[model samples]
Target: MAIAVISGCAPLIQLDSDAQPSTVNQVELGQGSGRMKNEQPLAHLYISDYDSAAVQNARMSGMKLPGYKPEPVVTVNHYVQSLMHDLAANLEILSTTFSVGVTSFVYLDGDYQQGDLLGNQLSEAFMHEATQFGMAVTDFKTTDYIRVTPTGDFTFSRDFLELTQQYPISVVLGGTLVRHQGGVIVNARMVNVMDKKVLASAQAFIPQNVVHALKGTHSAPLLQLKASQP
Candidate 1:
C-alpha cells in the first residue's frame, strides 16, 4: 500500500492542541521581540532555499529526484519531516503557542534541475510523520504586505511589502538547507516580518547516513535543535 506524500490544507488555517506544551526534554524558549499580535499570532514558514554545493554533489552522485523510485520519495520525505519537526520544537519554546503556516512555494520542484519538485504532497507526508515525532501547526497565514520568492536569501523589501493593506502575519519562518562534510544541516527561523525582528530560531545537523540512506523507512530522531533567542 502507498500513502499520499502530499502537503495541503484549505486556505483557512486551523490548529488543534492536545497539551499545555513544554514537555520534559523539550526545547527551551528564547527571548524574542514582543511584536506578535495578540489575536492572530501566526508563523508562516517558507522554503528558504535548496541550492547548495552538497545538494548539487548529491544530485551528481545521483542522490535522487522526484520519480517512481522509492529512493527519491524517501529522501524528500525525510528532509521535510526532520526540518519541520525541529522547526516546531524550536519555535514553541519562545511563545506559549504559535500557529504554524506554510506557503505553497515551500514545496518547489525545479524540474529536477537544482531543487526538489517538493509540493503539498511532500509536505503532507512530512506533516503526517512529523506529528508522530513532535511538530505541530497551530494556525497561520501570510499577509498582503510581503511576497517571499525562492530567492537564495529572505528579502524584506518595500517592493513587496508596500503593495498591501493590513498585514495579518505575525512572523515569517524560513532558513537554509545544505550538505556539508557528509552531513545535512537544517536551519529554521521565525521573524516578525513587519517589525524586522527575529523571534526564534533553530539549527540542527543530521548524520550523512541517516539523511542519505534511501532504501528503508527510518524515523527521524527527535534530536535537540540549537535554539536562539531574540
Candidate 2:
C-alpha cells in the first residue's frame, strides 16, 4: 500500500509501506525535480526594502554625544540629611526619653575646641534634621530673655550671661570632619552626656564641589577696602 502526503503548495510525496525507510535525494516538483547534493540545507536570500545608510544615520542622530555628565549640586543640608537618615536607623533609644543637642563639628586634625564655618553650618543642619525626625532638640544658645537694642532685637545670644545657665540635654550629637582630595568625610555620633556612651553613629561624604561652594569672604568688605584705598 502507498500513502500520499501533500504539504502547502508543494507537490505530493508518496511513501510505500512494504519498502524500507531510506534517505530522499530528490524531490519531484510539478515540472522539475530539486536534488539534495549534501546533508546541509540551502538558504535562500532576498533583497530587503530597508536602506543601510538611512538606518545608520537615524541611529547616529539618536545617539548622545560622549562627554562628562554634570555633577549634582549638593549642599551641607543634603549631606546632613543623609547622615541623619543613617543615624536614625541605628538609634536604639527612644527619642522622647532623650533631649538632643548639636555641637559644631570639629576638624580631625585641628584643636577640638576650634571649628570653622563649615562645622558651624553642619551643626545647624543637623539640628534641623533632628527636629524634623521627631527628636527633641535643646537650643542651648537661646537666651531666657530677648535683648532689645537700638541695633536690633535678638532672642539668641552667644553671651553666656544672657543665655540659660543649663540645658536639659541628655544626648549630644557631635562629629568630626576630615578633609580629603575628593571631598570631606563627616563622622557623626549621638552620645549620652552622663556616661559618654554612643547611642547612634553615622558617616557621610561631601563632594569637593559642594564643600567649595561655601563663601569664605564678604565681597562688601573687599569693595569697601578698595574704595577707601583710592
Candidate 3:
C-alpha cells in the first residue's frame, strides 16, 4: 500500500517541475514573459558581453567623484611641522640653547605689520612644533598681571601695553604667505634679533582645500540674509 501511494505522486511531481519555470519567468518578466518590448530574457541581462559596452563607456567618461582619488592626509600641524623640520635641517647657529619666539605670518603683499586669523593660527602651530623640536620658545604675549573676571581668568594678551616691552628672545621665527591660484606658498625663516641676520629658512606649499579646512566662528551676512527671507 505504501509503494502504491508513492507511485501515485510521481506524475504530480513531474507536472509541478514543468510549471515551475513558466511561473518564475512570468514573475521576473512581469505579466507578459515572451511579449515584452525589449524581449530580452533575464539570463541575457547578466551576460558579461552585454555589459562590456556600458563598462567601457563609464571608463571613457573620466568621471571623478568626490573622495575617489587618494589625497595625502594633512593638517595645519603637519604643514607647520614640515616647515620646522626643513628649518631644523638648514639651521646655521640656531639650536635648543637659543630662546626662540614665533610671530604671526603676514601677507607677502601687505605692510608686514599686521596679520589675519590664519597668520595667528600658523604662528601658534609653529610655537607648538618648535617646542616639540626641543627649542625654548618665549611667550611674549603673557602679561605680568593676570586679569581675573567672572567669565574666566586671563593671563595672555596681544596688547603691547599689557606685555613687557622686552623679552629674552634670541631668535624669532616668522613667515610670509603668498596666495596663488592653486594654493598658498609659505616662506618661513628664523632671524637673529640683534644682528638682523637670517639663521635658517624653509618653504612649503599648502593646498587651498587644506587651508580652507581650518574652522573658526565668524559672521556670514549672506547666509543670514537668506535665512531671513521666505
In TM-score terms, which candidate is top?
Answer: 3
Q: What are the models' TM-scores? A: 0.32, 0.62, 0.63
Q: Model 2, 79-102: lDDT tens per residue?
A: 899999999999875567679999
Quick one: best lDDT, which candidate? 2
Q: Is candidate 1 or candidate 3 better by lDDT?
A: 3
Of the pair 1 and 3, which is ahead by TM-score? 3
Model 2 worst lDDT run, 10 consecutive residues:
219-228
**Residue 220 shift from truth in candidate 2, angstroms:** 12
lDDT of 1 by residue, 1-230 (tens): 11111122211112122322121011112355112223433344322113233323434655432221222333555566666666556654644344334322231222322322223333344446534544344223223344556764332332443444443445555554554565656555666666767665666565655553433225433222344578
Candidate 2 has a TM-score of 0.62
Q: Ranking under TM-score, best-scoring first?
A: 3, 2, 1
Regions of model 3 farther than 4 Å from truth: 1-73, 219-230
lDDT of each: 0.40, 0.69, 0.67
Q: Pick the winner on TM-score between candidates 2 and 3.
A: 3
TM-score of 1: 0.32
